[model samples]
Target: MPSQPPDSSKPKPRYTLDEGAPGAFEGETVTRRKFMTGGAMAIGGVATAAFGLPALGFALGPQFEDGTPDRWQDMGPEGEFSVSTYVPKVMNLVADAGEAGKHTVYIRKFDPKRDSKRNADLPYVAISNRCAHLGCPVRYIQASKRFVCPCHGGVYEFEGKVAGGPPVRPLDRFYTRVRGGRVEVGERFSLNSELRRFSVRDPSNHLDGPWQYLYPSRPST
Candidate 1:
């Protein structure tokens, strides 16, 4: 018998856009490209958070917290310092571990004839060796009765008042107390322009002085 004609009613093989199209999803629901992109975005977010959190904490953590308070440190007998002279003394600060750190300060016992004698409580002045201009160590010139910065030409009188050169303000004054014939020093406080002028006989009174706008009236803690 002759073979019958092939059946024309048979359904043709169906072809869908999902089957062989480029960028098509595997299961018609979630595409491989979309899954990979989402995973990458999640990882990137996690990495950003890991680095950003610590930096944010470091900046804002101590804004409201009360920091450590400064305490008095002894600097030997009050008699050791003489009138109209700068006595260099080394002091150690409290540290976390091991030995404390050493720092130097200039102490001046004002002459009895000076106005500083009017206040018996403030008979002497203690100034930090650090220069106001660039934090350089200032040396005392006994002959000139001034402290001079070797790095710069910053000159300060015996009262720690800036007399000339690059220093913006006077040397920082340490809070001093004479207890049991021993001199004790404490936290440092910056002097305002008015107080700085009080210590000098002929202060630079110009509003547009060299260091007029260099530093703030009060130093930040």
Candidate 2:
């Protein structure tokens, strides 16, 4: 039994690099295995942080503010809007919680002549500047008395009814109200079915006060 305790002084095996003469490693060598393990743990920690923060934000982020339209929007007084002309007025719409900046809507004020003859009760008809076909901005041509699309040469009458082009649908009209003689137009909807198919008279052979009277100013509110 005493003879078995004689081999207690034997040295343990040492790990070494490829260019080993006698194994120069002391405590723990800066090995590739240790570095890879640490790198993997660090990457896993970063991934956990990336996914966890958004989940927390989703559960506890700020609530969205309401989106009701403001009542006191700026549209010039009734006198400033002429009777027969479509005057485009630009207004800034406030941004929502998700939006960055205010959105601008081009609201048109129908002149007295057009409003009195066609839309006596309602004086304003707000239509979007965009054309129905290619989403191009429609400009009112005073000489031709039509809304013309610059992109593809689409023509629309005074009431936003399509006169000629590849467009099958007419332009949209907004809901308007005159409060304290200030014309306020809400969001625009689709053009009325009757207005969409309306035909404009040929001005070359007309015999009246003016050819503009034939076109309707207001499309159903």
Best by lDDT: 1
- Taking all chains together, the TM-score of candidate 2 against the true structure is 0.47
Among all windows of ten consecutive residues in candidate 1, which has the lowest summed lDDT? Answer: 198-207
User: Per-residue alpha-carbon lDDT of model 1 for 48-148, expressed as tens digits?
Assistant: 99998876664454344332236887888987998768788877643443353666788867566763442345656877777767777788889998999
Q: Can you write out model 2's per-residue Cα lDDT over 39-129, one digit (the tens) per residue? A: 9999999999999887655433312312223444557777766545577766543334234323333445655554324443445776666
Error of 1 at 30 (Å): 43
User: lDDT at 166 for candidate 1?
Assistant: 81
Best by TM-score: 1
Residue 40 miss distance in model 1 (angstroms): 37
lDDT for model 2 comes to 0.55
